[model samples]
Target: MTTYSEEMEKLGQVTIFDLLPPSPSNAFSIGDSVRVVITVESDSESYHYLEAYHPIVLKKRGEIIEIQGNQQYLVNFAGELHVMKEHEISF
Candidate 1:
């Protein structure tokens, strides 16, 4: 039987042990409360502030989207969902 770790490795995905924890290693996890440190500028044509320094709950971790290498996290605020980079939030 293929173990979870082996399956993840075969798919070219890093297993938990392969990652170095961020500075505040114990930072935040799914369901943890977080806050926006800066407003996220929309990537679309609409010129609007996505969010400010508002309290939000960590929802889920998203896949790496670009070559710049920052990972995105799903957060919920005011019953709305938004994606923000790790550096853009505070726990």
Candidate 2:
């Protein structure tokens, strides 16, 4: 596992580890609240909160498609892939 500071460095400028205690990391335990922001960097910065925990795989290039039911989103991240649930960010 990468430390919060180390991951921040890897992400370069797309994210920040701030506004919350860096204990739980990206995985949110029950009753845990956290503040996270992912900036995809386009015309402007995109900021939002990431739900505590639920497995998420991040990759530079991935496939995105919408499924009808059961598995709603099928994502191919890196050479390996997995199923993931939807997530939202708080302002």
Candidate 3:
């Protein structure tokens, strides 16, 4: 019989994102116009677990300025730049 440690070792490290389906926003490219879909707190407990986009970015529209890989994007909201994830934005 396999021990709990052995099973955990086999599973390795997994995050919630890994268990969820890929976001359609994953296909977003530079120059795409997108809008922030969710508000995240910079001081939340889950802040470390996910990207923390400022509340100001919530419901704001921006253009994708760069693709940071791993589904992260650098967006230009007016003159300000913020890094966001695919799930945080919509077309």
Each prediction's TM-score versus the true structure: 0.40, 0.26, 0.53
By TM-score, is 1 or 3 better?
A: 3
lDDT of 2: 0.35
Candidate 1 lDDT tens digits, 32-82: 666655533423221123322323332332332222233466666656666
lDDT scores of the candidates, listed in order: 0.52, 0.35, 0.73
Enumerate residue pairs that collide in model 1.
none
Candidate 3 lDDT by residue in tens digits, 11-71: 8866576698775556798899998765345344434333454544554588999999679
Question: Model 2: how large is the Cα RMSD against the reference?
Answer: 16.3
Ranking by TM-score: 3, 1, 2
Q: Residue 77 deviation, candidate 1, in Å?
A: 0.3
* lDDT at 55, model 1: 32
Clashes of 3: 0
* Candidate number that wins on lDDT, 1 or 2: 1
lDDT of 2 by residue, 1-91 (tens): 8899778777874544464445423322222222222444521222322113322332133344333233233444444343333342111
